[model samples]
Target: MDLHYLDATPTEAERAAVDALLGSPEGGNGLDPGTVHGHGDAHNGGHPNGSGPFPAHGAAHGNGSAHGNGTRDGRDMLLPALHAVHDRIGWISQGALNHICRQLSVPPADAYGVASFYALFALRPRPSRVLHVCTDLACKANGSSELCDRLEQSFGPAGTAVDGMTWQHSPCLGACERAPAALAFEAGDPARTQLLAPAGTDEIEESARSGPADADREPPARESVPQAGDPELRLLHRVGVVDPDSLDDYRAHGGYIALRNALRAGPAEVIKQVTDAKLMGRGGAAFPTGRKWDSTASQPVRPHYLVCNADESEPGTFKDRILMEGDPFSVIESMTIAGFATGCAKGYLYIRGEYPRATRRLANAIAQARERGFLGRSIMGHEGVDFDIEIRRGAGAYICGEETALFNSIEGYRGEPRSKPPLPVEEGLFGKPTVVNNVETLVNVPLILIEGGEAYARIGTERSTGTRLFCLSGTVARPGLYEVPFGTTLRELLDLAGGVPEERTLRAVLLGGAAGGFVRPGELDLPLTMEGAQEAGTTLGSGVVLVFDDTVNLPAMLLRIASFFRDESCGQCVPCRVGTVRQEEALQRMAGGKAPPDGDDLALLREVGQVMRDSSICGLGQTAWNAVESAIDRLGTLSKGGPA
Candidate 1:
């Protein structure tokens, strides 16, 4: 392998751009480029240049500039540096990485590690223009695979560059509402990107070749949000009605009322409201939001961190994207409240990189909030209560959705989950007390503070309080986000989504995302609550209800699900790394009508799943087997001899 593509050497302009962002000279701070790169190849087992894993360039260097502690040594420069390089050169070059490493005093090996960890950063060379077509469940159901095939037929192979363009299959672009969505990055300039839904060969070819020309292109109109029966739509109220970009429109529609109430009540009172409301983490753990806030507040640590996890990489889930894109200010305000309640002065919003629209909206929202004094020092004129937020974009790691993994990503390391015992509340985000809440979870903070926790708690089941944002997609007439209180049966929720398409009998539903399990058609009446899901051997994880009808191929779908886990395992631990691959292999065998020699691939899958669940490091590996196992047990895929 020539492997020259892995060697990214920054030009003079690229180096200058990095210097402007990092506020440091190239190879500054007495760091020698030769020394850094000398050890770099050793740290990460050497570059793909046939040397070995990249080497550990140097020991960990600590600087606080990135986190707002104001140390100027470029410690916080990792993400920005990468972005600058990617933007200018279209990909990270080895020269660029070395320059960044020297500027930030980050070891060359570590810098390379960070760069390679994210999915967006291309390790190998390719065209500046790329088309990211979502091939996840919802998109797949809507012909995303066929779309990929067509694009490849028109442009080139999936990952090959042709006519200054390359198309790659993405996990989920969070545009399930407009299924079969493809985000085209014109010549790799993000600002020049275009989102095309119901994309076919023609649209993809034109978008890739002509770069967003109006001629012969009819971009699909934005999907409309379903009208909620209740006047106060709660989460879904402002989704379609209010202008996402207009901060004034948000305020007119009652945007920061919760923040105002939170400031009046004080941090303790705000936390009490959340605790009283019985709100839980919407990111799937369902831990009490109030309890998390209280724990962080009680800690003696100073500068406690509040992280709003907007990674939202789950296959069938797009609710967080909807919330962030439609009501960016709400997420910002919710984080502000969270920062105030936790006694933190700073927060980080880790939005998925694929969500360019959501990311842009949030960036604008944060700037507007800061300008309006809702953020920054002494927010909203609250004396001694200062809070600000920073946005961190994820490159494309599904595991980063886990709280600890997200912490690692922000700290300028590979996105990998940390072992628990200390927990995030005790030691997180730079080894201080931290609270990592999902976008939906934090959004509820404002609602709880405004309505009082007890009043808010009354909406859902006693244990699972408040309306949950359920992402409904696939084989349904109305496939979109629906916010319903807990205890709403799956049947009722499906009915709200207009149920399965006519004449298509519901076969199975994958509740939660890839990490969640399957629910049989007979179990549609099961309440969409944590408790209800637990009793039914499924979970309400992330509130992703992906419906599948009789026309779908369950065996192939299971194979795809398994393949997702295998590709996304991060390879940190043996159990998850190896187990996912094994599970995928077993599924492939079964799907191919060629079970293992023993003819018990299902048994082997169960054994492997048990090991992963009982021993894997993080939820990624632990829950990796949930969907596959559920399919084998509930849907008769294996017994029926795989896909027709």
Candidate 2:
């Protein structure tokens, strides 16, 4: 979409590659019957003259070359593989990469390397609920830093000692239009202590500034810090101070104390602590951390692996980056405890390449932890329980966040997802059982190890108990992150995120990451819970909440998404490869204000989006239509509206 000024001066091979990628009879929506559900060639209906533009410098992906697309295979294979996969599996998951490898006679590692090299595959099991929080530079500048502060204030301390709650920060959840936003939250209970808010303080000064109508309004939200028997006062008590600046400050106030306590409790007690915490992965999937630890622990496995998935590429989500940069030790401690619980000797933190600052901080933290005897062999003087932490940096591929592909990348292979039946927990990283958790999920470990489970279960609603961290961004005075109970209403989050900027009409909101659907303005009052979001026909994927004022152009945004998918795609599956191209073409026509009034372009865009949604081989191609579909549902209002 950004290449229009280049004058279409593609080389003969480039032209041919583009043409082949588009194929003949391209008028129809790219969805075909072959893609509903099966395994087949990913390049069936593409160029027959062979993929034309194979970049010779494959090493660039590894060397972090600026020009490198960070793709694993030759660029030619990317298109074919995407087309082929689209033709077979309506949507791609971890399993498709293995099938592609089998058909291509490439090692699963090679295929996975390619898949992971791009940011489009969903390698991990889809969580029951997903949350995405934005932490882009713009968002950060607009108070994502403070938003992260609010979230940590609310969830950081509680998550560690409590059983049923957790939270983490990600980097650049990709909703650039909306800054300081997050997505996703499951059900959970609330703690009885007011550890976060000042006594009798109904609203924090900064939180008040973020609110609308109440811009000049201030009221006592709590009354006299109700007596010990006052349940209402307890539920309102969030667990931490507002924006306490340094990690050392966090330590002085009581950070890593849980880890120390867990170490004292020993592995069994530590495992029991987590089991009691009821903490679940906060990166969309709600797998119980303790349950995962329990399973990995009892299996009598050797070389069990633990991977901290810091590849937060989900659009509209970026909470992990904040945790890495602001609270690195929290995650580090969690990883160490996870190793202890699962008996793993080594663990890797797979961080995305986009955040250089976070990378440096994590490296520094690792060094600090080691020097303190908390990371290397015999951590904290625990005999026979040694674990070392290694940080693996991804070369700018969103799909590498997928556990399998991440594993492949760590092994020095291309980044592509692998098929699953035998999940990473049973057979992962180097063919050993592995427990991969999100940053927020890991951060909850030390807390759970310090507290009992029954107490943790009391926070949120059953089946979704615990607190959640939400990044709030969009047309608002104060956009940022907030940590609240699971059942908090969207209205409250909006108020906390600094209600929409004055003079802007709340047109629509995109919940979760790009994979989530949209919600109209009228739906703003919906509860900010996983089930509530689902009831609105969208998911809380990555806990990113993006607000669109009336001025946004939906079609342009759709085009942007199409271009993003097309560019970021590893080109392994047909539906995504070709379908994204087709969608982009249609969107280009619409964006250029040249679309015909007959509705042909609109129809084509819709058709292609539908096809890609139903036929891509991985989550990237599959969910690419989320934004498009949401926009279409809004009937041109989300876009500039030139045609149809």
Candidate 3:
């Protein structure tokens, strides 16, 4: 096949950025030895999970499917090259994109399509210092709209450059615990990013102009882990107690002990322990971890891959972010254990782009682990245990949280979901047998291996064994990540978090997330276990326990949730793309009292939602209507769109 060339010429800076990542043109060959930023073993046959041999000083997705090539050479670097140009300049220009295309052997138009896919990447010209203020659910409940209004009053409307500074509304930054958050990203020689929570209009303005220099630091990792320092705490015990940056502290405090245990037990025994524990995935899917590992281990294919789904983009759900931010080393150690047990030599840690601090900490942790002989070829002492981890960053897309979509994103394609049949276990992350697990799920592996599987199983219920992490935000008094046994009731968890804030009466709780259903305050005794929630018509989706008070606007909250799905739908499937838009429109019409000409927007919404639920390719479409339907059924009539 012939590759068409773009006539555009890149700027010197653009050329430099591309060259820095892919290396110089090299006699016009457009290929080189430079990679897309990783510590070691950047090669994955079917995809680029940060293990490809192409070495670069840095980091970023994409149109089309896996292209024809010797596995994935220059093709996988498409996302990273785009990141190079975008990070150097605030956006991806035609010239920069063309340069990247020539280097990667991908068509220029396809490259542009991929660049335009992510919510974070800028295809149009934009300021280097961009302030992304959260206007999604949790933030809105905390007066985020008021902050936006104030910023507009001070500066112009969002997106308009004001003396080289600009601001824009963003979805959840996974900092719902510290509602009304904003993240500042300044692009330059060495790009800098900072998170601002409890964002004051004045503080936002200052951070906007001052850049990341005086940007207010986010709440310490411990703030997110409210139950930190507790002896009974399993996953979060070390979050606030130890220095996250110190390797020695991680060791002295019992880190890597699980890895040692796994090594002694061997891969088969590791699988047995996890299976005995009956550990289900903490990701919304709730699949069995041991089964996933066993299937991958049993695959006859060589070079099995491991992908840590650290990209938690679900609204009102942020347990993964807190875990990575607080305990970076633990993530690495867990991935290492996962790789060792699954017969995989390479691991990909795909973190969300919005988490600047977590990214930095995990990157540091990966480098330190590699340098300390914990990662790479050979074991800490045992040989033939070659395993290494590479960090992959997701550029603003909620759907990438889906497992297949994550593989596509890592493979340098559009972050769109692939139809299942050949699941990640059989053909994933480069069409090879792969094992995928979320941060919270993988972190549980060490615990399971350390404690005997049967003993661990007894900790929780018969089916849903072990502790679960719930991201408590919104009207809760002490909003943070809380850990409790699966059988704990919603009432007990709320009491642990000090119940509702300011003595306000609880109206309802959003279990799971936008993709999960709602429960009325009267149902406080419902257990948090998967079986219990399912029996009540909801799943423990991502462990989101977002509380709402009597003062909250249920209709408006539903509208926001609808808007989020509409904005995030990949448009790969018509039901989801069209249904999401229709859902939002119907709510808006009802909100403004302009009900459809048929005078039955509720009926239209139900139809559209059902179509999406049945026909959509991924869970985003399937569960898009969950919260809204739950609100109408459990809360009350929303036909008038009260206060929306």
Candidate 4:
């Protein structure tokens, strides 16, 4: 709640949408039964008109601090409210924005800022339905371009609606296993969304012309777990073996046994086990999970918080999505363990919006967990251990993957990374000690507690303990989630996936992701361990291994990667905001040129990349140049015939 910025009067439909989410104003906050809120007296130069400045008024809210005169602030609901409006109406209207402001005690300008920050929430009016086709790395390697061409011939263009629906290119939908994917999101009561993987033009047309019911539904996440029932598969043992929707199925497979073990052992023992296990985060940072839990638990602060970072938006990474959709109970149980170990009473599972199936399964799991007393007060019949998880959906900003930026997004601000040092463990989520772990990292906790730290530690290299989930996509014969020990070499993993199709020879492997590096075919012997990757001047970042055949247009892929960075940059800091744009421009110039790429363009790329790496606030900016640099240096890409 800031100064009076609500100038426009909301339509009945707009007001109803906000009201549905925030509750009616009748007898409480906002307008009277007959009078509209913010509809100042006509004599005072304010009415329910779309124009005319709002008249000044005293604080109407009951709580106050950093914001305006109001004592009440519903700013945390900003993202959800914007979502409500967008889901009800295809786009966010000025009136609807102002209405949400009044309901949430937020300023109109601030609401507008938050609304425009997300790619999913359109400020202007749009069709009620949207078809998001993936033109990303894995999809491109598949037949995504041809799919787009087919879509173009059927529909007018990507954005223009043929009837009441339209399709547009999207970044990775975290369905990398199913390349050439398309997601349809329709707005209205009981809004519908469907995934169209291996999206044939006919399916897209049918879904667009009629409804998602006419198209094939996405396969269960469990189906994507290639090594599901393998006794050796620690992370994915129950993925396809157990029913995702059943708590009984999860328990029969040994779910919550870790929580019971954890409760009996106490938080201290749990931390010690994780420490001895030497488990690291799977969220690209590879930070020691034990150290993070220890620091947060040791903090003098009260009411510690745990955030399950499930917003997996990395261009070629989708392991977390698979895990959440497959063994959702494990993620929940792990988050519970984390909350208990860290003394956190509340945990937030910040998930991505595109993961509808995962979201649904997680929500169901949370409800079942709460109902069975596995998540509420006195968990497992123990005294005074209270913890619950709330799911937060990210609208579509890659930067929110950064812990601080995620904090900001949850707090209802634009998704942008904040400066560190008062790091997240020290001051996070409402400025408290917080332990944040991604889905894969948290799911491993159950294994550590059950297997004993020493045994879990022995699964992989002594340095990088336990198994790793690699998202093997692109030209590989089998493109899916593969779990292997850390010491496994790239060649071994490729072989495990059956290598590229017999006709297509491997050109290179894009390890990590857009922010990761590229490896030449000869480098396949490199061990798939963190230390191994670092020693080789690259990283196993988030376990993304996107393979490409020699037939792909590699430079175009580089340009697409460049465009992803440029589009996703929050533009809060100059280094990433400007560097990403310049990088894309340089790639376009060099790739578009008929002559050989000049050394000047390559040099310029390096210079800009260095500046971004050195000055960018978050990892997104710091590693923006990583993949491009790897392509240039290792694969000799972006040159005479680059990225091929």
Candidate 5:
């Protein structure tokens, strides 16, 4: 890599702003003085034990400065520095990258690698404003392609800046309820990032032409789902009924009571209750939540870590976003209880970068909780027990949803998954024993503790206990988030979502998101439980049920799904990197009438898929071919002569 390209330097004002945000003087490096290092002493740079295999990924170091204080080194500031430079100047100039690398002691090549990994960071010079339009499956069904075409007609082709703005098609923005979502990012004021759902040409044009002030206009109100007051709702009980911003309202609706009970019962009892409940993780893995907590607690390592995986980027899955934006306090309370049970004093909530509303609500909730003593030193006045949480935002990397990759992102590295064996529970975040649970998994903690594990277990099936959040999207009469038990049949779920529209027959259903397989309409009676889905050669991944009607172009949709995996693969390993590209090319050939009808492309696809699954490093590669494979085998996607 050439070093000269990274010679761009940050302006004096940009350096000052970053220093002020980090609370350090010029050229300072290390954590700020008195910054809590959980169970370890702050002077030791947060890692009491020696550095792990990848020290630069998570190790915190202190530099000998005149101030003699521990200021976070350049590695720790990678994300913040990127944000500062991008905010101060429209795009990350080579000068800015060089300046950031110099400040953090990061090599320019390594720094450039990290910067280019995320979708938000722009290495080359770009227009001050950028419009990221969603063209994923959910949005595509809702005319996102037409929206993109219209924008291109008005603002020129994708990636071209018209009147100082660039528009580009993007992956899922996690806002399926209000489909056709677009995010407007303006330079100079990062806080004013605007989300436009049902984004029209006029709205996007106005946003791009005007400055940040116009971009800050309130988004159109989303239509409310009909199931809010269904009485059976657990996770979403408070979503639409209560004011999301009002803490008093949340407390009034029996919030924090679970935390109080957990505190009274102590950590051991809390873990026991969870174990008894047999609660499975809702983030598709279905791992026993209690066992994960128990294993992390049993670790001999000091200063254990707890991570809340709120990076909900799975296409057509918006359940976590609904919970976070609606009941932010519950997430905070749940993380606190998780911290106590796992003997973790420090927690990190990694939310998706696209979820502006959820991010705001969570940040507000954390601040409010800290003020009320629910967080910070001696949480809720439990002397000698300290628990705190820090929110880390993801910079548009889908692979970061993986636990190890998320930890790496928090440690200021490229969001790529690490090899398993020293799994997260063994040697996870910061090279310590850590428990990483998704938002839905952590949200269940308080409920299990309050109702007693057995009582909670009675709500659902024996294996998949308790209620699950199902995201219903695509060509359905009522497409929204639905709360249902694990044993609920796919047919019943569709009925709850009001089924397909009048006169429309269901063609097929994608049981999960892109990483999940498909089930034909005939299998509607199949139970939506984990066991049933597996038996059907599919998965109830993230509880996403995307309904496809007779009018849908199945071949095109499968091709789009293939394209998504190809674009999002982190490219760390050969199987996934090359396999995804090969899979996409084969799918494109078949979809474009280029493949012979002798079934060679489909066979090649299956072979490539299996290789990726068997040899890939992470789940992203393993499941990349899921939707396409399922569509071809189960739904006759390619047999129907390409695109309808």
Candidate 6:
């Protein structure tokens, strides 16, 4: 853990802020239907019961009212299996969470909470080809709404070819400010939908799987390449530079050149290429990919592992979607290389439940790779190094983004995060040393191996090197994914994103995702670097830059964020469990019409926020006070009944 990025250990004043934010606290217990219907206040009553395990996808579906064979054991078998199916399909198009709940013996609230909490489960069966527009504050400013409208008009019942396509509003696909943005994937394919950005009607429809192509038909021409400024180019880049699923297409774009070289150079030389690249993890915590590989390589474990973290739930980041959908094979190739270097025989790509298409595509690609001799036993006829990969689905807990939590979720347990010490390299997945790399970081391996790591390292800053796939959103004219060198100024990114709104002045920018702190307009000049942001009292969390314009109220905004964390907290630790609820009460009280009487109450709330910050176990409790502190610091004078 780096000290510079973390603030001073929770101060008394900070603890007060946490407490104030959580004005009231609630208890944790199992959810009861009777209590839900007539109880006075379940809000303040207690935590709903959240426990147990079951199958992955053999449950029932329908409206909230039960319709299936109602047996306790039968229902239990059905729930997890239903979740598995829904996770794979993106929504319970044919069944409701309530139906699954009744069939599985889980409370409706618990079932619904699990369904709604994650991004994968959709209440309604989306269009055959789903397009999730990025509507987070950043993309909102970038004309994302307009893009959605355009898409709906063209694809909806009233517009062009309504035969197979459908469009729906998807919450943040994490590509904020990459506006006029959206991610497109087939509903049933599961293999096609990896997170993508800057995608709109034209791009989606162009590459969408409309129908089966003629088996004998020739491939499309590669003559017309799109320019960077072109809208289609932006969408293409967001979908990944290379489309790895198409062997012919990838070959045309110089796809297997790196793999051929890796096979020729052998594992040691391949490892050196990656080591020289200086590529850091694209997944928030910028750990070096080479070092992770080196540790795994040094260990003589027989079945070494290379797991790709594709569970992209960071509120403002979605670069992985592009890699998984556009060039999934790159990830496969990278993992294969890792297996060769580390003497590993297997790999897993942990994709979020929401991205069924990416999962499906990778699964298919893996099968194809095996047939083509790229994976399993001998690769392209070479002996000595053999590898294979599998896909694992996450149940949609944000905490699962934490590595240990991810492992637990994979192990068929509740997705609560775990404390880390015997770091992933030494102890991960079944007590074996593992290498878990971000989707983007693993994809970059092929590039680094093909080109020396030093060449790759030269693109970005000293500490943060290489081109980063930044999911830019909020208040910008053009919102979408941008691959730029690290340390780029906020102003430059904003400009590249087509600038902020003309009518509204800029307010504050949320760097990283929900866990990160804010930077007001005055701080726009702050360099967009991990170290630089830390210096300015914020961290580049998940690299999702969400900018807000003046129309947004900071206090109210902070309240919504606090509420989100409060609702999402797994309730494993008291500081986080009770403290978040308290924070919510304080924010509501302060924001509500009734203002606090001057001294003591205000002081108390502030103190609570600090204690929660200091005492909370995981990232959820620890940094959750960031927005509240920023809000109070920026708007103390404007607060109701305050000095103003």
Task: Indicate which candidate wins on lDDT.
Answer: 3
lDDT of 6 by residue, 607-630 (tens): 877888888767778877776676
Please tell me which predicted candidate would have the highest TM-score against the true structure: 3
Tally clashing residue pairs in candidate 3: 14
What local lDDT does model 6 show for residue 296?
A: 79
Per-model TM values vs. the true structure: 0.90, 0.63, 0.94, 0.92, 0.91, 0.69
Collision pairs in model 4:
62-71, 63-71, 63-72, 64-71, 637-643, 638-642
Off by over 4 Å in 1: 1-9, 24-73, 187-191, 212-224, 228-232, 596-598, 640-644
Cα displacement (Å) at residue 617, model 2: 3.4
C-alpha lDDT of all candidate models, in order:
0.76, 0.55, 0.83, 0.81, 0.77, 0.58
Candidate 3 lDDT, tens digit per residue, 296-364?
999987668899998898889889988888899999999999999999987888888898788778877
Mind giving the per-residue lDDT tens digits that candidate 1 earns over 103-188? Answer: 66677777788888888887667777788888888888888878877887777778887888788888777777778888876422
Worst 10 residues of 2 by lDDT: 190-199
- As for TM-score, the candidate ahead, 2 or 6, is 6
The candidate with the higher TM-score, 1 or 4, is 4
Residue 363: error of model 4 in Å?
0.8
Deviation in Å, model 4, residue 258 alpha carbon: 0.5
lDDT rank order: 3, 4, 5, 1, 6, 2
RMSD in Å for model 1: 7.0
Question: Mind sharing the TM-score for model 5?
Answer: 0.91
Off by over 4 Å in 6: 1-244, 597-606, 634-644
- Candidate 4 residues 1-644, lDDT tens each? 13575467777877776665555677364532123333232112121211111221221111222223322245666786677677777788888887777776666777778778888778877788888888999999898988889878988788887788887889889888888888888887656788888788788778777756622257877667777778988888888888988999999999999999999999999999999999999998999999999999999866577999999899888999988888899999999999999998878889988887787788778878887989867888888988877677888888889998898887778887778788888878767778999999999999999989999998899899999999999988888999999999999999989999988889999999999998999899999899999999999888899999988888888999999999999999999999999999998888878435757888899999999999998898899999888888878786655444
* Model 3, runs deviating above 4 Å: 27-29, 32-70, 214-216, 596-599, 640-644
